[model samples]
Target: MTVPAHHPAPELLLDYAAGSLRAVQSLLVAAHLAYCPECRAQVAELEACGGVLLADLPPEPVSDSLFGTLMTRLDATVATPTPVPAPAGKSLFPGPLRRAIGAEPEALEWVRVVPGVHLSAWGVSAGTASACLLRMAPGSRVPAHRHTDSEMLLVMKGGFSDEFGAYRVGDVASYDTGTPHHAVADADGECLCLLVQDQPLVFTGPLGWLLNRGFRF
Candidate 1:
């Protein structure tokens, strides 16, 4: 595994520790932590802090109907587990993504965004969150774009670089609506990344208007 050069923001780590982040964000964070020991340690510390804070809170009593209502809801709701793929030799893909995608990396059916770039979107809730696998060939570039909500990128293989910095395998690059930047894959090899976003992106470049029409980004 390559050492990560970037990581999720501190606020995100805090949200993750408190279980307050959305499922898509958690999925990206979990995938990053699979290879980032530095972040794992940070999360451990944050969890400890959360534990202390929780312990200090005063206890509250629940309504008499709370348990019955909870049970009723549980009985009414159905659980859908993410399908797991059969072992396909050894895979470098993260467990969380592998489960959600339900297949090995090579098995993903990617949609071409442009030459040398492709995407495989997951069926996460619409307008709430989105998760996908972005594969870029060596030297490929994603046109400059900004997000309406928070977005996170976790490199699974190879690497890419943006205005913020270079990111190798295991690195996580997190951004918000404020920053607009383009990314280019490393020249050495193809790059595979797990990308999670809460809202659509707003492309900002010469081709912004055209790209947005096609990608709805």
Candidate 2:
């Protein structure tokens, strides 16, 4: 299949390869991997590397009672109830996210913004962060903001700019706390991106102060 306009960051992809992402982050990356053969191939290479390393580990014989101890631990873990289905609201980009994130997802709760650009909260894990999709009109300026935690952007369509450079489709950018970044849409068309924010965004003024207090993600 053709690669989507955007690709997940190599770091994020690495995390996926390393199995280090949060459950939701993994889900989104899993969706991306499902569609992108290139990434799938990369992940396979990583798995191969891991296998080689595993092969280098010293072999050791197991003790007999180790099996009984492991089984007791597994039985305890299995006894807990499974998680209930997510409520109609509060679900974040359940796969077939495209099926759920769009002009008409009543659950999306689109935010009010410029006439052309659009934004909506997709995942909210509380004081830690949330995921969002932002669409910008040609030449629109996305506000400059200070990061309290990490920030990542995956360009899905069109392009945008920040102080660092223009990010076209397929480019992934990342920033950690204290970094400053901003964007303006491409001159020719609207830009849409998926953002997994690590901390609440801090605007440049009083509003930001209020937001900082109200929103930690």
Candidate 3:
């Protein structure tokens, strides 16, 4: 299982292996694993490591009926498939990304960034924080810049490259807003990424600031 040039760090896989990643985030990781068998082995290895650690641990005291109860539920589940969390609405959004962000999911209002690039701002009611869905035309590149807050880039389709490495479909790039970098795409190929961010975007130049100010979904 060859990982991309810049794959999620081991910490992320540990979180996933521990089931700490959110469902949405986990969904993307599952997709990435589909492409990377080496990472798959690594995850399995990690899980095995965890299992060994558990083997040495003291067994938890449990009621005698615990085994029977577990078997009962496992038997029942065989007949009924569990429901996947999808959008609850009259009509679902047009894309996988939209549907993945269900539960009072915001709309994707395309706002022009450059001639070939677009961004859709998404807001949440609980916080001033928001996110975005970004699209870039083949070969287009956003100005290299730094972020002020943490950002999550989950690729739904296409790919991009930066100083770190190239990211293809199903890849996620998490960055610290305090750090800075530049990203670009291959010529004539488009890439769509779900940008989950909570802080303001720090533009590197005049146009960048203007675009950020006017950016809205």
Best by TM-score: 1
Over 50-152, each residue of candidate 2 has an lDDT whose tens digit, in order, gives: 7887899898989989999999989888676888856555422334445435443444555545455567655446446577777778888765668777877
Q: Against the unseen true structure, what C-alpha lDDT does each candidate score?
A: 0.82, 0.67, 0.66
For residues 1-217, write the lDDT of model 3, one tens digit per residue: 2355455668878888877765545554565565566678878988898899889999989999999999999888766567886754553222444455553223455677767778765533224445557788898877655677767676656788777777877677888767676678767478877676656677777677677665543
Ranking by TM-score: 1, 3, 2
Candidate 3 wrongly placed segments (more than 4 Å)? 1-3, 23-25, 64-109, 120-132, 152-156, 170-174, 196-200, 207-209, 213-217
Where does model 1 exceed 4 Å of error? Answer: 60-89, 205-210
Lowest summed lDDT window (length 10), candidate 1 = 119-128
lDDT of 1 by residue, 115-135 (tens): 788877444544578887889
